[model samples]
Target: MEVEDQIRRIMEGEGLEFTELDVHPDQAKPATLRKTVSYIVCAVILNDQEEVLMVQEAKQECFGQWYLPAGRMEEGEAIEAAMQREVKEEAGFDCQPITLLLIQEQGPQWIRFIFLAKVTGGSLKIPGEGDQESLQATWWDRVSPLQLRGRDILDLIDSGLKYHQETWHPRTLPVAIPCSHVVQRLVLIFSNAEEELWVLLVKAPRLHLPTAGAVKTHTLMWASSLVVQDALGSLYYDQEVTALGVLGLQHHYHPTPGRLQSRCSDGVCFNMLAQLVPDPVQRDRDGEKLEVVPPSQPPPPENPRYTWKRIQSQATAEELFPTVAPTSHQDGQRADIGAATVAPQLPPRPRRLRELGSPEAGPGAPAAGHTDPTAGSSVALRPRTRP
Candidate 1:
């Protein structure tokens, strides 16, 4: 009796629910149940011939592909009307549909409507004089698998031809299209104090595209940093010694030098003149004269410091030996003497963190005439002192 009672209760619940069910779709399914409308794309082919009109594809989404004239259907446009308009715009010729070639359904979001079209009239031409259309339309023959630009085109064509004799349904899914961007780097250098900056533009030739021009393949940050190192090593004594911060920049598509600009860390731009002197004992005995002095031979222990007082020695000598020397000389002789004048002595200014212009010689501090305090500085002979 208990088992029978349980069965009775289940049946009563089922009966009540079934009695309340509505069979009409208006009550059973809401209007919102509609699936997303799939788009219809068309492929129009001219009659059996060696030439089939085609156009080049653009944009990172579908780059370098040749596909049939196709697009999404506009509001109120019949599916056939959309196909006709697409063919006219893409192929520039009137096309009459003969048969539906194939259908490609992709996911719940995409549908492709393809057809066999016959060329009737109006010469096939590219749309918008080949500028606004983004492609040049032309006739082609012997469509090879290798010649097709994208897998979509190849798949559509093969499916159409293969299924021409029978009806078939295809199960497909959406695929992600990948894209990339190019990066550019710039190095700005001020070679003079007049604020005249020279930009060094270096790029790998392979990174450029025939159409796009100087496409950057890396991030601007990485490019700029690498270029900074390269510029310092190739142009200066040390990267740490001379470097500036980046300046304003705009996107550049042209292939030119100095696309990027920057300012030196220091406001001034200057040149560095360095000399290395060897120990007196290790001075080169057999080699040609060199700017660098070896370590084995140290410079003299004491020498007059380089200063205006030392530089004025010649003027003083001329004054003291007035009776032995002529005050006036030929212009050519003076010019020759001037050319051989001693290098201007400079003082040490703390090395600026930037290079913006030719540096002025620093003032020399008082010291042994022939000895520079800095370990790497040069030593020059000073006037001899009478004992």
Candidate 2:
């Protein structure tokens, strides 16, 4: 079955609504050219001591050089399945992915999916008789020098460490409803005559960004737009709304009585940055134009709910809304000015499946491990004990 057809069937089975954002042909890279693209999935498995797992390749070209447990994707296989299979085969551990860390693409030809995974079962070991593709698997402190298979992997390792330290954002999903599962908010930024920027603040029950609850039938953006309109009034109804980027992520957790905890127990809030030209059309009851008021002023009686605070610095605005900056490619065109449009359904690209009997084995093969010459250096190799 076609991929899109399969996706549609799954969506239908799950009783989910689908929407597509229209991308102009000129803006979209050609899909036909990407049919031959290859995908590589890598797993970053870190132990409690901040050590990373590495595998040595048996392939002649990079013999004895260490790298992450990674491999190419097989036709008809799911992404998570591919990651599990690679980690099991290369590192000798049956693992489950914790979350997707990164999805890096090079043009339309090469794509890599990096995942953070935790070991669930299976023993670590060196490659035995039938599996010669890998020489060894071991845990490394990541500080010692070993013959690395590729120099580029070091950058990826750094990214993995950074992700482990500070997650770019909380794990979020496009939910059909705003359950306690997720916290959502919208940000409105404006500029004044001096080009100084300000952020809209609400003085309702507390001083906080405008909050919106996601609905079962609408998209997050749609729901957030509604909240913006309702909170700010009709002055912003006709303005184009564009999401700049994610402002920040906050995870809420119930506190324990004695010991401190870091994990969120309640829910996670995903704050989206929205930008618009603050050209107000409505006037106050006194017939005065609704100009940007000082941040300290009490919410005006007419619209006694909203106020604007001048941003501390230009650098602050750039940091919060990086996409607002103009680029050389956008010198003559305004890329940030347009609103998103819903497009008609576009056909899915044709999938190019790898032949079953090709020299390269499918990614679904049984798990195996490798042994490296550097296995003796600070690297620990724990073999699975047989029953």
Give each model's whole-structure lDDT: 0.30, 0.46
User: Model 1: what TM-score?
Assistant: 0.31
Q: Any idea how many clashes model 1 has?
A: 23
Task: Write one digit per residue (lDDT tens) for candidate 1, span 174-202.
Answer: 11111011112122222222212222322
> Root-mean-square deviation of each candidate, in angstroms?
36.0, 19.1
lDDT per residue as tens, model 2, 1-387: 322232222222221111111111122222111243345678889888878899988777677788888887665445578789988887789998765544433222334556788899998866562266577798999878888876545545664675577554333222221113233455566543344565665665444455554332233334345645655565554344544443333332234465344331223234455555433354668977676542332122235576666566544444333222211111112111112122123222211111010011112221122122101001000001111
Q: What TM-score goes with each of the models?
A: 0.31, 0.43
| Lowest summed lDDT window (length 10), candidate 2 | 374-383
Model 2 misplaced regions, further than 4 Å? 1-21, 26-34, 127-132, 172-387
